[model samples]
Target chain A: MVRLRLHLVAGIVLAFAVRGPAFAADFTVPPVPTHYVTDNAGALSSATQTSVDAELKAYEKATGHQVIVWIGDTTGAVPLETWTGDTAHQWHVGRRGKDDGAILFLFMHDHKVRIEVGYGLEGSLTDADSSRIIRDDIVPRMKANDPNGAVSSGVAAMLTTITPSYAGVTPPPAAENVAPPIVSGAVISMFGLFGVFMLFIAFVIVMRIIGSIRYGYLVMRKGAPAAKKEMKGFAFWDSSGGGSSSSGGSDFSSSSDDDFSSGGGDFGGGGASGSW
Target chain B: MQQRSWIGPVAVIGIVVVIALFVGSAYNSLVTLGQAVDAQWGQVENVYQRRADLIPNLVATVKGAANFESSTYEAVAKARASVGQISPAVVQNAVNNPQDFAKYAAAQDQLGSALSRLLAVVENYPQLKATENFQTLQAQLEGTENRIAFERRKYNDVAQAFNTRRDTIPTVFFAGLFGSKFNEKPYFKAQAGAEQAPAVNFSP
Candidate 1:
């Protein structure tokens, strides 16, 4: 009887031990779907998925860059960024050679979100940008226990920054800040001449006023101190020539015409992860 | 018999000496490659150590601001301690002992999983993520992780070279005789979950 009990116990332990690796082998990162929106965690509502799916599909169709939304449970027991990065790399969403893929990852159970930027999109979807989008747009929704809300708003925020141009933002011409017609050197030079002419007119007006005030002080009236006060006001216009045009920011909203696509892009493991 | 036939004896001696020299050169080459594999392992360990070292600072920095779950921090601490359990002696012999190598690799993998979980937990704490110290630590940890990945790849390459040399005809026979530890070294293969090649669509 004692030998039989020992054998039974040993058999049970052996069975469990054999099953352990078998169970471990079953756990895998979810495969990527053909669509841009993959909601394996069931965190997203079908309605939300439909809308997001359409939007993402249309965007990808218009521009080759791939932007995917993935919602899984707890990053499947792995580090969120690494897992998301690995997924993004595997999906190869962006254009093949350009490596412009990005994954908007949401670990629903973990309440974490990451934007795994590909090599091509690193300049546009920067770490700072991703972090800001997560902190500002995604975290609040996740905090409220709304994963879909978080993803939608977060995707919107990202789209707002997407210039339809390339990933990295470029500085505009100084002439653009000055005025719209300064694309050519001739136009820029003409604007410069116009600014000089405006300065000349103001200078002439100041001289006339000073001449009349001096005349009044010497021959017509005696208000030299008061006229001197008027001259101080004229000094304010001196610095105005080079200031107003640059300060107005008329073309501030102008963004790039560049669009993002995988272009066969790859990822060097760039992205940020956050939990709510 | 004192027959003055030195040519036969001299020729035999010279041939024996030449063969010894050839075997000596091959053995020396194997020794050098083995050392190289060891050095690569050192690099791999060094990167892992850097990552382990950064965790305390990461945990401390995260602790100050975030109201993150305590279990995550505990898990990281536990994993870290386990990783530290491997001694330098074991590392030196890990190449020769598959069991030791597996234990060491398992420990590092656990630490990686724990650290990643810690970072994932940190995601929910926006305030913590915003802090300068937390950001710096996060960057360092990520950087170290990448270095570890890169170094592990290099380690495997050198290990492959070393093992092949050891397995080559005469070296295989003489490896145990020299006792220079020129055995096969283990590759740093992350145990399941991390083993899957991530999904990708690559446009040419």
Candidate 2:
């Protein structure tokens, strides 16, 4: 009986010893990769790009998570503009220049649906605007597990909102044809109208100069004697009137000259003697 | 002589039984307390996860309201990123390493501050405040905070019991031998300046 009791106690102790470590080792929630794409977008403007980059960096610091963002026109093998229509594209585009488009993509590693917005469409459609639409119309649906529907709705809304901004700027014609708008005819017409107006003004000024010269010559030839008589009569009358007004007239003339000289730098010089 | 022999045998058996019962009860209680602690940890983790999950929507909503305030938006984004960056292994290490726990605490504090700033800014936006999704997320976050407080309390209770057992006189002897003494865990104490929820400040 003594041996049997001892064995039972030993067995119980051994059983507990075996289970204790295992129970202690078991932990909840297996470790997962926490890296997430915070923002991914098409070619963004410099200002928008700077803001997005700063936002992502701040996000990473605040969250202690790795945020992988692709800020450019292309996704992997396909252009961002095309990637929106199809998912098979893998080409990731980086910021190049004014012509190169960019996109902003935000991907949470654990989350199924990622957010992608076109930063290239800033003034036309802002980050805030796109985010609002997504959060309002798409994110709720996505959280409810309808990713396909959410994406479709988001894409449609974005396209509808953005298309009007590029009313005349046509889409890429073909693989090799990616030229911007020409607008040469409009520019030519604008310049042409300005040139014609300048020439018309010049013609009028020349005609007036010729007419003035001809009138001066005609007056000298046809009215010389009459003008001489009138001048003599006017001189006689001026001399009679000048005796009492000489001092005041001299003061007024001097002051007027002074004012003219002082104001003569740009405007007065052109008008002073000409008006007289 | 016959009576004395029976007394000796009976005395030995009683002593053995009493010793066995004492050790068994102690071991069983320790195990049960440990399990409770583990279960409470799960609840804490769940609430934390729910908080984390609420972040993107909150951020998105705030982003919509105040797009020009890049600094505030950046703060929110950084907090969200930090939450995402913290790996589970790092969280596990936090249980052992005080420094790791500090980092964890700091990250959580940043997120809380960012959320406060976000909510404060949301006051300027009546349209955003009226959004159904934003309202839902806000409600969920509030609920999650309450749940977190409850879970933290439960965890502390279990931890207190475990620590008491490991510190008491005779049980401390076994705890020391087995190296099962309770480690101190930092609680989510509210920051000094953090008062009422910022969401309450929304006028509309």
Chain A TM-scores for all candidates read 0.53, 0.26
For model 1, the stretches where C-alpha displacement exceeds 4 angstroms are A1-276, B1-7, B193-204
Report the C-alpha lDDT of model 2 over A33-126, residue by residue, as the tens digit.
Answer: 1112222333234554444344433432332111223322223432222222122011112111211122224222323222332223333443
Predicted candidate 2 versus true structure: per-residue lDDT over B25-134, tens digit per residue:
88777777767766767666666777788777776766767454668767877887887788888775464455776787788768877766766766677777787777
TM-scores, each model vs. reference: 0.42, 0.38
Show the lowest summed lDDT stretch of 10 residues, model 2 chain A: A267-276
Residue A12: error of model 2 in Å? 33
Specify the highest-TM-score model's number.
Answer: 1
Docking class of 1: incorrect
Clashes of each: 39, 37
What's the DockQ of model 2? 0.01
